[model samples]
Target: MDWVRQNLGHLTRGQIFSIPTMTMIEEYVRRDNQFIAGPDQKYVCSSDDLAEFNIPQGISISTYDRSNVIKLYEHTVFRHALSYQSDSPRPDRLASVAEHKGKIVGIAGASEDSELMWQVGVDVLPEYQGLGIGKAIVGTLTKRIINEGIVPYYSTEVSNLQSRQLAISLGYKPAWIQLYAR
Candidate 1:
């Protein structure tokens, strides 16, 4: 659990964990932009402000409705964002789209993977990659979920460093990481 030891400070620090109902020990790590602890007490930790969550000005991001998702991504691979909505047993849904010059260039969507965790998936047009479009949409969508009191989680292939970095830049840490063959 070296990853947890090394990154626990970033996710949470200095907070006393006395909540007995916590099935997951890592859940005690809360996000406080200014979580400063006094001294090295029995239990204390900390995290740095790694990245700016806000996007550049002039780029707009907004949530889309069921019908709107199809119209927006019918021509793009992000069309998959709406696929589960039509499933017989579907997941909770929330999505945000990024636009430039009135064209949707990126989409960030969450499908509830568990009772308390919603998996985040972001897709950006090839031309828009690395311009922070993915981050903008993902950040916005994550905030929306948190506003509703749901945990937003991100998972990527171990080889996908860019995706991992983006998630970290937004303050997401490795809570439960594992690798398995398909």
Candidate 2:
């Protein structure tokens, strides 16, 4: 704790999570072959700052209840956008789906992380990747979450440029970073 206080306390939040700083912390504390994980980026957008996105010409976006969301849980391809963990404190509460030609092609789901905050995740089919489906569904869900008086947040691995860009394009700002042991 003293080491963390002295070495990391003085840095700003963004600086504390930089690669060099995280590497230094890892080197200082890692024990015999243990591995470290993360540097995941967390992003959040205020209701006033949320951006608008247009639904693609051939795609339709609609909200889905929990039961409908659960039907897609077995689909590994959409794992990032939807998960049903019975014991999780943060339970998934809402999903906005994008359908093309009557087939579900993309989904944006939100988990109620806390009373005032919800975390969002998204997945778009490989064939529909370049289209605006991800942005549109996420934007729709984000606005709905905000309307319910809760903050919407998103997180992604540091290496996922597309996911980061999607969040940024929706007007989400970096709130924090996490580095943890695995």
Candidate 3:
């Protein structure tokens, strides 16, 4: 089967380059560059922009409160789940954590040394599936992570259409393809 090369090394900032897909790449360039530049245009990609939910663990719902170190430790389950989707653990994971407003609802983090990058993770508190919260969280995380100078990357089992769709919805194209061998 034809497969794309997966390079953990980043091309720009923390951005990981997956094998480029012509269609998706074109879309990315167009959308990212099409933003209107007005004096009133607010930069909408910070971790602090989200205010719809109560702060979990004393931190804002989507904001990174590094002071609350304990909250950062709570994302291990999600970290493992996200890692499992890929063929291997992300070698440069710098931070990992889950966010909960009563229960775990989001997960995100960075890789190695780059701040501008794509961190991979997921959310959905069992009862929250199908509500678009997963998609929102991923969007929130993606924008926040990418804004930090890291290119976020993630993978899911080829069978997971929900996740695959979600990733595509957020502008993440497959960087590489993986086939498990016994």
Cα deviation at 110, candidate 2, in Å, is 0.7
Off by over 4 Å in 2: 10-15, 18-21, 24-34, 66-68
Per-model TM against the reference: 0.63, 0.83, 0.48
State the local distance difference test value for candidate 3: 0.46
lDDT string for model 2 (1-182, tens) is 89889999999987987788988878875765556788789999987789888998989889976556666566567778876674567878888989988888998999888999989999999989988899999999999888888899998999999999999999999998778776
Worst 10 residues of 1 by lDDT: 37-46
Report every candidate's CA lDDT: 0.62, 0.86, 0.46
Candidates in descending lDDT order: 2, 1, 3
Which scores higher on lDDT, 2 or 3? 2
Q: Give the per-residue lDDT digits (tens) of candidate 1, residues 1-182.
A: 67446644445332323233222333333332223222111110112322457775667988864445444435457843434444424453778888898887888877767767777777888888888888888888777777666677777755677877778778776765442211
lDDT of 3 by residue, 138-160 (tens): 66565656565656665566567
Q: Give the better candidate number (1 or 3) by TM-score.
A: 1
